[model samples]
Target: MTRTVTLCEVGPRDGLQMARGRMATGTKLRWIGQLAAAGLKEIEVGSFVSPRAIPQMADTGEVVRGALAIKGLTVCALACNLKGAIAAHEAGAHVLAIPISVSDTHSHANVNKGTDAQVEMVRSIVDWVRAQPRPMRIDAATATAFGCSMEGDVPLDRVVQVAAALAATGVDRIALADTVGYAHPALVRDTVRAVQDAIGDRLHKLHLHDTLGLGLANALAGLEQGIREFDSCLAGLGGCPFAPGASGNIVTEDLAFMLESMGHRTGIDLPALLAARALLRESLPDEPMRSGVAAAGIPRTFHPAALAA
Candidate 1:
């Protein structure tokens, strides 16, 4: 049997949040629909953050409502605090992701709180979500888990400490994020192993970046460590506006192609996934979109793992 990997599309939320211009809510919804149609089971539609903080995601509530209309699509949203989590819940988001940066400086810059404070906030958010009538999944994404550009080398022990704290908070899952793209293959392996030892199965996903062009390599390392879920952006669009020099996320098209070619079942249609780039091109005309598979085009002999099965 072939192993299956889950790719959570984060273009609409993480990708667009860093975009220079705002994408209309309607366009975002259509792009999300296209992604879902291409067999993406989960998508981070938008962040329930203050409009003043990120104007691009101001209409997240509306986007969540629209995304709920699509059957079998798990709509996920980002929330840094309890207020944002409440708003996401009210909007009917199936999953709420709260980023807790391991670097104290980066944490303050990104979410205006220290790492310990953010952990407590996550605890509070988890409590509130459980008290609510509707059941929603909560994910605590540990940003800068590999390293931090602002604070320099973040010790591995600190990463495990934060993950353990988050696990104790009762979050359904924990995702390790290479927030500034400083991770290499070895670091990826070691970090995942360390976090797993600390939090066990709670470390379920990886959020990587391609700043130094090693995104795919690091992802391969994560795969070797038994991480099944990953966070990627369509067209390789996204960066941390708060984290200096952080750039493009792992490209969805390239990742899907790589996984399928390697006999890992991703369940994503390559042709349709490439076609969805048109929406971004047409909407964000000035934004640069990067993709290795898109540039070379799909090979004739290519076979996806789903078909191989």
Candidate 2:
């Protein structure tokens, strides 16, 4: 069977969080609306981290509420701890992703917790989420599952162990992330297979970054491994504000165009996705934007707009 894929737009959260300038809430909502109109079914709207840590997400509650109004969109948000998880729940996030770095050093530096502590946090968050009156999905993303910037070449056993530990938390789903873009294609395939072996059907999404320009390559490898869900940003909008020279997450428009042209259905209209990139450019003029399809322009043979016109 040819597996279908789901593109979960992370531009609103991951893209904007690490950006230089903050995007207005209305503009964020507008961009989100454009993404929905482009046929995206799921979007990571914002993070519940401290406003002091990531001021760009100060208005996460507002964004979540606005996103909730959009029918059929599974609005997700990142939460690092139990506190952030509760905030996500209160903000009405349909799905809450808790990131736990695999490397002990990275985990400590990023979440101020050791590996075990982070696992405990996930446990608490899972329990808290299940107690909510309204149903909400929890996805635990093993950040730096392949490699880490602070700690290079994280061992495969470590990543597998973390996934195993997170599974004990009873999360609705689990995802592996190359948070620093340190992952190569082979490593992506191998690690994804490892995690999937440990968690089976619970392994649902892959979050990749373009730091080394292999975002698409890694994504393809994961797809070949039967990963149906992917996380991407519009116009490649974000990078680690603290980690200079790192590019943003994988470009959603480019990824969608690639998949659809290859006879894979993403349910997204390529032309509409490109138009949404224009809105992002207009909003953040100074921010550097990047995308294969947006820059190269669609070929004449792939006239998506002509059919719609």
Candidate 3:
């Protein structure tokens, strides 16, 4: 029997945030529908932030409403602050991902707050959600946990401290993120271990970027560390506005194939996922993409390497 891994698609929110071209709300909804049809149970639909800052996610509410119609699909939205969290909840988002930068330099640029304040932001958001009539899950991802382009290597002790504070806030789950794609396999394992030591079972997911072409390698290291949930984008679409020259997250189609080929169950149809990639390509023609399985098609006689990923 093969093990199961959960791949959360973040194309709509994280992928589109850095793109220069604007995508229509209806196109976003349709693409989301395609992703859901591809057997992606969890999808980060959009973010609820100010239009002046990121006009790309201005219509997150509408996207959330549309995604809710997809039965059995978990609609997630990225929220920066309390206002964003409330907006997401009202829009029917099932999960609220609060991206907090552990690197002070990155924090100031990305969320305009220091590390401590961001932890408090999580506390506030969690409190607000608990008060809501509907139940919502919180995924507090520590950005730049591996290293920071602005601040350089973030020490493991500091990451542990930050994750400890977040865990103390009574949040549901915590994720360590290679926000700028600066992580390697060894660092991936080490960071996962340190955060787990701090947050214990609260640490679960990894939000990775492939800026240095180490996305899949690092993700493989993460799976070796007993992590099951990973954040990825279809067609390899993503970037950090604050981290200059940083690339997208791991490619969704490629990661799916890699895991499934390793004998782990992802429940995503590769052909259907590629077809959804067509929708993403048609929607964002000018966006740059680099994919492994796309460039080199799946082999004819490939054998799975691991019994489980």
Candidate 4:
């Protein structure tokens, strides 16, 4: 039996957050439904943040509610603080992802809090969730775990420290993010190992960016280190508005293809996944979509692990 790799589609949340124009609530729901149909089990539906801050995510509550109705899909939402996490819980999100930057400068710029403060916020959020009657999984991402655009060369020890802190907070899982895409394959391997040593199985996912075109390479390194979950955007839609020079995330279609071709089970329908990209194209025509597989169609001899099994 082949190992199953979990791919969490973050296009609706991370992808749209950086889009030039806001995607309508109905359109976003439709695109998300299409992605779920394409066999993406987990999807970050939207972020629960102040509309004034990121007007694009104003409809996150509605999006999360709509996504909850999708059967067999794990609906995830991004929350920057305790208030956002409460909103996500009220909207019936199955998972709440909180990002804590490892770089102090980027942390202040992104969340107006230092790295230590964000870690405390995560602990508070976890305590609040435990008190609630309803259960919602929490995931904390150590952003800029690779390197930061504002503060270059975020030390690997700092990344492990942040991960250990988040894990100590009792969050269900932690993800390492290459927020500015400054990571190479070696960095990914070393960082994953160090964080795993501190947090063990708590570090399960990698959120990589393609700024330096090493996104896939970095992911491959993570796979070698026994990391199974990844965060990707359809049509490669995402970038940090706060982090300068940050590019879009690793393409969902390409990542799925790569994983499937490598005999790992992602349960994604490549052809169907590619077809889902149409909604983004029509909805955000001016938002340049990126994908290597989308440009050159699937190979004739291609075989997915799921289908083979």
Candidate 5:
């Protein structure tokens, strides 16, 4: 078997949610298609939050429906509660990720509820999904797992506790997210190990941000900790509005280069990914997009065996 890495493209939701302008349903579908064409096996198409709360994601259902047409790809959507989960499941998303903010302050700001309340809601959400005729996959992501911008450094134990809580909810996966980008390499390694110890193999994913410029370093730490699935945004566009000083997510193009250079197969075509990023930049002209590989260009000397195939 070829050693592989899964890169979950989150630009369609996390990246676009905070942008200056909203993308039409047709445009969002076009972007999802481009990402799927570039060989990304999974894409976070959009979120199922209330339109009044997040107007940008109002068309998430349509985006998921359209993205389902792409062959050999998984469509995912973000949902914070039972209501949103139903929408995502009804929209036919293959996976629905619920962000369980570890910080009470961030949690209150994000969903108008604290961490305890958030945990209490998980079982209800899971039960409701199970009752559905075709329940979608669930991923309980521990957002702000690292240091919360609102509440200094979060204890490793707290992060692990939340992961355990999510695991008890019968979620399919649990991902640790550096929502504010405040983690160092050691923290990532230790936290991942602890989460695994608490929740077993359910700790398979990491969602990182480049806010403090440690995105790649943390990702390297995660890989060393046996993590394979990563969440990144195209052109590094996104931020947590509630988390002060938060920046865009880890850059997908740059991350793909890093992973491929290290002999891991990601199945993403560098040229095709750049083309997709260009289209995104064109669509959101005013939205700031960042990609080290995009700005500096890929080194001609670097070629991975996976890309050659």
Candidate 6:
């Protein structure tokens, strides 16, 4: 039996936020609908960050509300602070992901806060979530867990410590992210194992980048170590604000194809996913789109699906 994996699409949020041009709200909605139609169950709709900082997500609340209307789909949003979390929850986000950088320099530059400050932000967000009438799942994603572009090398011990601390905050899940595309497969395997050992099932997902073309390799390493949930962006539409050309979250279509081809069930349609990518290209003509399987095409001998059909 093929192993089942959950591919969390982060295109609407992470992918578009770093895009060169801000997509029209209706266009974003269309792309998201296309993805969901292709059988993606979960997607990060938008971020509740400051409009000045990330203008692409200026309509976060609108996007969240729109996504909520999609049946059987889980909508997630990025919340950097307690206020953002409140906005996301009110907008009807099912999951709220708060990023806490592991590298002190990156943390200071990205969130304008150090490790301790990030921890406090996570704590505040958790507390706020607890008080909300409709609770949203909180995921503490330790960004730059593998390495930092500004800081150069992040200590693994620090990553472990941050994960443990976030885990202590009563977060529903903890995630490790390679924000700058600095993680190799070996590092991914080892770090995921270590974090899982520390937090057990609390370690929920792995978010990676394709800056050096190691995205799929690192994802396979993660799968080997028992991580089922992954974060990916459509057509690789994201990049770290600090690291130029470092592609945003993993490519969703490619990742889905890789997993399904390897006898893993993603419950996603590759042809439909490719068609969605085409829609995205039409919507964002100037944006640089990416995907391994989309470019290479599915092999002639491969079966479309093998599990739960």
Candidates in order, TM-scores: namely 0.99, 0.95, 0.96, 0.99, 0.97, 0.97
- If ranked by lDDT, best first, what sequence of candidates would result? 1, 4, 5, 3, 6, 2
Which of 1 and 3 is the better model by TM-score? 1
lDDT of 5 at 245: 95
- The parts of candidate 1 lying over 4 Å away from their true place are none
Full-model lDDT, candidate 3: 0.89
Q: Report the lDDT tens digits of candidate 2 across residue range 13-73.
A: 8898877778899999998999999999999999998899899999999999999999999
lDDT of 6 by residue, 58-105 (tens): 998998899888899999999888889989988889999999999888
TM-score of 2: 0.95
Q: After superposition, which runs of candidate 5 have C-alpha atoms over 4 Å from their true positions?
A: 307-309
Identify the superior model by lDDT, candidate 1 or candidate 3. 1
lDDT score for residue 129 of model 5: 88
Which clashing pairs does model 3 show? none
RMSD of 3: 1.9
Which ten contiguous residues of candidate 1 have the minimum total lDDT? Answer: 258-267
The alpha-carbon deviation from the true structure for residue 236 of candidate 2, after best TM-score superposition, in angstroms, is 1.2
- Whole-model alpha-carbon lDDT for candidate 6: 0.87
lDDT of each: 0.94, 0.86, 0.89, 0.94, 0.90, 0.87
